[model samples]
Target: MDKNAATDAAAETPTQDTAQEPPLAGRVALVAGATRGAGRALAVELGRAGATVYVTGRTTRERASEVGRTTETIEETGELVTAAGGTGIAVPTDHLDEDQVRTLVGRIEREQGRLDILVNDLWGGEHLLVGSVFGKRSWETPLADGLRILELGVRSHVITAALALPLLVRSDAPLHVEVTDGTAAFNRRYRENLYYDLAKNAPIRIAFGLGEELKEYGGMAVAVTPGFLRSEQMLAHFGVTEENWRDVIARQPDFAIAESPHYLARAVAALAADPARASRWNGKSTSSGELARVYGVRDVDGSRPDALAYFEEVRFSGKPGTPDDYR
Candidate 1:
């Protein structure tokens, strides 16, 4: 179904359950940035498929990380994973610190013995996206701030994969998912900020770079992205909760195409289960909507909205029509 049809159907149905056997049973997975958003959702979804998930993040119930505005901690995400039926272990580690990340992986090796899936989702750079002339050229933005984005967003992914790839390669059919925003086709246009554009585009390149190395060991890596995600912090931005998010669509019609983190979560889960078809997606820059069409999984209230398609046609074109047709 298209985005609009799915959204309309969601409004009519209270719930849509697509039942399946636990495909990931006996598997082990790790999400490096499981504080919230895509990382948290990926952990829970993997658990739902019966994979023991190691969730790592800086935030805990005791103290918050740099993104301290919200209270959703890594411990909470781990608990949610366990509640969903798989073992969840929450380890507090600052991904920016290579030593801390190495130690965390060591613990996972000690406990799980093998790592089947690795999700490098450690993005804590949003706190530094500040400046009067933000989203300017590389020379325009503060040099330190721009480099800081590379440190938190790009370097952290490299560090986590550097340490974790060894263990992952030992597995039967390992999958590495590098989460980012916008697909390769969508991000070709300059995102305006040097750091912002680089940070977002690096993951796409990582998948291709890593895929070359991983091919030797029959391992795979792909950069994954969600459509406009209605994450917890995003909900707060529109001054509404998930329960009442539809209300904001009136003000910003494009909001109608926004999807929950679970959409991407399930997308990765589907990938983990279908390792035989790994070559089809290896090294590709993909999104939740692209996978949803293939897997037939549903999003919030079973609605499948494609934010990229809407953004490309409507948001980018500056069309003055409502999202009623698109989503």
Candidate 2:
């Protein structure tokens, strides 16, 4: 991912309640796929909230990796987490490999003894994008390829949670956050892509199913979606800088309703800190905008951009222009 993009986006917004108490000082957390995007930001935010975080991903300092786009190393994310005030452990892992995932969790269990939070963000869907589009139709795409996306996006989460369950079950306040796209019920156009939609929607099901299964264990599982995430790579894709991102709305109208990954990170941190969070959102798929409203946290610009609402009230209204015009 574009480190520059993240740096610029974060710099544009004033810091949030950094002086507040660290609510998760003793908590042990893990953010899978922490190399970039929402996962990377969430790891740092958790650290800011005073939780030791294990940041795991395929990209590492030792070797150049192949998700084939801009890459962020696990060590980089870990360092950011540490800088944010929580202990950060960089574990280079490919979640699709069950053995690798098991070993990673084993190490965490050995050292931490208990897992307080697990954020399953293992999406290597970049591989599925052939020239910025799905390679084939839903049925046309090779079943194996589709299955691979599901394995990385959904199954890896299950395997990691299964391996870490014993430790999580022992924690006083265990929480599982399944990072995903918009709600399955909402079902936007989704680029008319089949496999991508399935992969994106799978996490919602996983969150709900896991919530039901883990309820007896006193754990909560909820899926979350970020707004039109203005990632470094995305900014580059739209040919805009964070300082001038508002201008991109002229071309890609939806860009006006963007949120930095850190916005979602803050939301996740807030939810994790709330002792009654599970009771409020267990088994639900929520958006960053919705969470911001519930928790009263602001985005990077100190504004709570209710992008979901914009989509519903404006984009869905069959207006003459695209989402960007509203900005």
Candidate 3:
């Protein structure tokens, strides 16, 4: 829901050893909250697979959203997707507004006739995490900030899915993805703050319910989470660029396993391309690391960084091991 870099190499449609065509050559996808981070990368990756991707978010070159950052915009995401060899349309949308979401779905239906993929990656609450969620109890947190997180993370996804599903169900192999912060298993424990926990868990439930409802239509829905993501904002927080990200690992050992936003994009793209994805992943809650292992996807650096494994085996379990052990 939130980072952005699309490499030229990544833009080129990846060909398999068998000389297969781009898997999604004639497909259409809508990536909500694609202004930056994982959402932006997912749009670009889908384009690389030859899907015409509609990239939507509140940030644009002409206007900034409450997120307040001007560095990444939906227009730039659209351009990146186009550069990746698929048509990219930038739509400025506030998903919390039902009318706006309806208009978006109508426009998509008018232009594309059907939607193959619907990605709800709408969270933009990183700015509110520090003081509002990290160390506060549910009641101790500022009511407005906590409510805003729910608005961005929960309500937005619901609105988008409700409006978009009608068009999505028309596709032959519709795939709905709910992008959240943690896998359902990992999130069984409290995610620091009560509001934040609920915000993240809601998507998983939404995906499950949608999956069940879509079964009759031959559609698939799954919730996915990226492992210790090396988002643009995360890099800045560590005072390092991606090129020199390792320099800060000594200060934050867990950063050693941080993965690029592209990893999650690759997972979703793989899901979109798989013919048997419904059987493989429908109604499931998975992480990028798990998908990467199953689909043989590697990070941009060519390593499969399993942040969940690292946390479960070493960080949380008190095992004697380094990030290298899991990655």
For TM-score, the strongest prediction is 3
Which residue pairs does candidate 2 place in steric collision?
A: 1-70, 253-324
Best by lDDT: 3
Worst 10 residues of 2 by lDDT: 318-327
Off by over 4 Å in 2: 1-21, 130-136, 142-144, 188-191, 319-327
lDDT string, candidate 2, 1-327, tens digits: 256745665565435466775898899999998998899999999999899999999878776455755457889999999998899999999887789988988899889888999999888676566743375677777777777777777788778878777778788767988998787556555745676787778788888988887788888999999878887667777788779888886667677789999889998999998889879989999988888878877676666676776787677776465444322
Over all chains combined, what TM-score does candidate 1 have?
0.91
Q: Per-model C-alpha lDDT, please?
A: 0.85, 0.81, 0.90
lDDT of 3 by residue, 152-207 (tens): 99999999998999899999888999999888889888999988999999999999
Itemize residue pairs with steric clashes in candidate 3. Answer: 2-37, 3-36, 3-37, 3-38
Per-residue lDDT over 201-294 for candidate 1, one digit per residue giving the tens place of the 0 to 100 score: 9999999899888888888889989988998888987999989998998898778888899989987888888856467788888989888877
Runs off by more than 4 Å, candidate 1: 1-21, 130-133, 317-322
If scored against the real structure, what TM-score would every candidate get? Answer: 0.91, 0.87, 0.94
Residue 83, candidate 1: Cα error in Å is: 0.2
